[model samples]
Target: MSATKQHPFYKSLTVAVLLVWTAAVLYPLVWTLFGSLKDNQQFMLGKPWALPKFPLLWSNFSYVWETYGFSGYFLNSAIVAGASTLLSVLLAATTAYILARFAFKGSGTLLNLYLSAMMIPMILGLIPLFFLLNEMHLINKLVGLIIVYTASALPFGIFVLVGFFKTLPRELEEASAIDGAGYNRTFFTVMLPLAKSGLVSVGIMNALNIWNEYIMGTVFINDPSKYTLPVGIAIMQSEMQYRTEWGPLFAGLLLSMIPVIAVYVLFQRQIADGVTAGAVK
Candidate 1:
């Protein structure tokens, strides 16, 4: 078959697949929205996929937010995720820039170490990490969680930003030098601004990862007040088993998803650009 003739068939196939995928992704969100507004009777008697009955229980959100400590959990998650994402992206940008541009001895080795770290399962270090945090008296603290999240996210950030830094023109640096800009000034004012897409992309990815992180939060934090959203949700699930507060449970889940969804929606263009940047260069 001619390439032109095959294009339509392939395009149609792609459209069909995308439609199916869209439905698959959207259904759960719709279901969750419906379920959050429902009462216990609706959950027990109504069909699983049924729309919520009249007089929607908007109080489900309030119930979870106030009755359980989801508000605190939300704040804790925000703090950890926001702080860690900022630290990780800043540190990664600087480290990646040095490695990509400076051409120092052992730079390749250091980058290789970061790549290797990415391959290692985070679970393997949990025990040691737990003990180390305990020794530092950082266990059960949000600051400790923030630090851990920042470190854990660094490898992926470095891996991504390194490519971005390498693809930039060296003439930018030379020009900055000609204008009497030093290394720090050149990086901060010239190159860093130029790599905004990559930074935003990495920031969003790291924020999402840290926000959704459960195991580390659950392990490192024992205080109920210190619980992140995921851990709080897990606790809410267990506590609701006897109460049958499915509405509040669903509401909690919806709350947890808001930040993640908002971030992707806002920065999706930057993410797309970041992915294609190296190829374009």
Candidate 2:
């Protein structure tokens, strides 16, 4: 084997950049984890970099989970994000499949419309959306939020999955057709499974967006009982000035991050594979 030809300067620079970025991202999470074990005073007054005192208060998580209603909010967010991701990704995959496979009048237009929808800042639709939802009697409802989240996530999902669908070998669909599979059957059983990587990629992204989304969540959900985690956390933070339990607040924040982290940990390989495959094609 040829001796490794190392570009020392470039290698050193790359390592330095990675180390800096890693530290920047990791420090805050570490600090937050440590702060969760202390009370408000220690978090505020004690050295910000120090570890928690000997008797780390694990009850802080329980307190945030129960006393502050994060449990309900967390569950509400899970339902909203989960439902929205599933519905949006399913719709997007079907839409993408048709656009990628079929050549017909206005198919391009339809795809273009979804692409254009991505450019329109969701904020621009807020006033009209509110009125429309209110007229539909969906204000402050979890179902309303689910629909809103699903719709908001659709365009991006379609954009990503369309590329994957286009990249798929046409022979797969041809074979499925020769086997007497209809369009729906071919799509659901063959094409869909083939595009699993891209679907998971978009689904995880949509879930993360829906989970962490604040503005739409805050606007649509008014009842505290129905609040999603981000909105609920903001509400809790606002109330914290009066209650002053910083440790449990940090605990709540940490809990909110677990889902996104877990998703990336579990499906990161598929996400990377989907991205590069879509890109190369």
Candidate 3:
């Protein structure tokens, strides 16, 4: 078999596989969109695979947002996810920078400790953490949840950013020092900006994880008003047994997905580059 002939075959196979994969990924989203536009009668009596009927019910979204209180859930999620991501990235960047650049006693051990912490499942610590937060009078508070998320996200962020910091040229720091920049100045004005891609990757990943987190929200939040989107969605599901509102439920789901999809689409290039930055160097 000639190289050119084999190349075409592999290329064709790759394209075929990608096409199939794309369909698999897109079908559920399309189905969800169709489901969201439908009424309860359509789902109960009509074909499962049928397209949405005429006069799409866009009010489903408004109903879920206002009547069902997804607006509150969305706001809570945004605040928690945004705050946690910012704190995690800031702390991780500093910690990673120090660990990567400076060699001192116990620094390696500290880094290793952080790396090992990531290996421990969050479930293992949930019980103790709940009690600890309760004792601190932080349980059922957004502040508590934010603190928990920030702490939990730290290990992964540090692990990723350590590699990124290491990849950056030492000469940059040296050059900054020569220009009369102090440690904080150099880090903020020079090194941090250079690691923007890594920061973006870490921020987005942590945001997504926190936004979708249901277990913690359900466990810590007692007030319905304090519920995150995932917790809100779960509540909505439970209520479905008594009175199913499939349209609003699907609409709620679609609403949850939009921010995540938007983020990935906008910063996907940065994410790819950041993930690979550490590996290549």
- Give the candidate number with the greatest TM-score: 3
lDDT order, best first, reads 3, 1, 2
lDDT tens string, model 2, 1-281? 33343667767888999999999998998998998999877767757678899789899999999988998998999899989999999999999999998999999999999999999989888889999999999999999999998999999888888898897899998998999999999999989998888888888889888899999888877999999999988888888776678788889999999888899889899778876766565
Q: Which model scores highest in lDDT? A: 3
- In candidate 3, list every pair of residues with a backbone clash: none
**Candidate 2: what lDDT?**
0.89
lDDT by residue (tens digit), candidate 1, 1-281: 78976798888988999999999999999899999999889888857679988899999999899999999999999999989999999999999999989987898999999989999989899999999999999999998999899999999888888888888899999999999999999999999998888898889889999999999999999999999999999998888677768899999999999998898888899887885674354
Q: Return whichever of 2 and 3 wins on lDDT.
A: 3
TM-score of each: 0.95, 0.94, 0.96
> What lDDT does each candidate get?
0.91, 0.89, 0.92
Cα lDDT of model 3 by residue, 119-150, tens digit: 99898888999999999999889999999999
As a TM-score, model 1 comes out at: 0.95
lDDT of 3: 0.92
Residue 232 in candidate 3 has what lDDT?
92
Name the better of 1 and 2 by TM-score. Answer: 1
Task: Give the Cα RMSD of candidate 2.
Answer: 2.1
Candidate 1 stretches greater than 4 Å from native? 1-7, 278-281
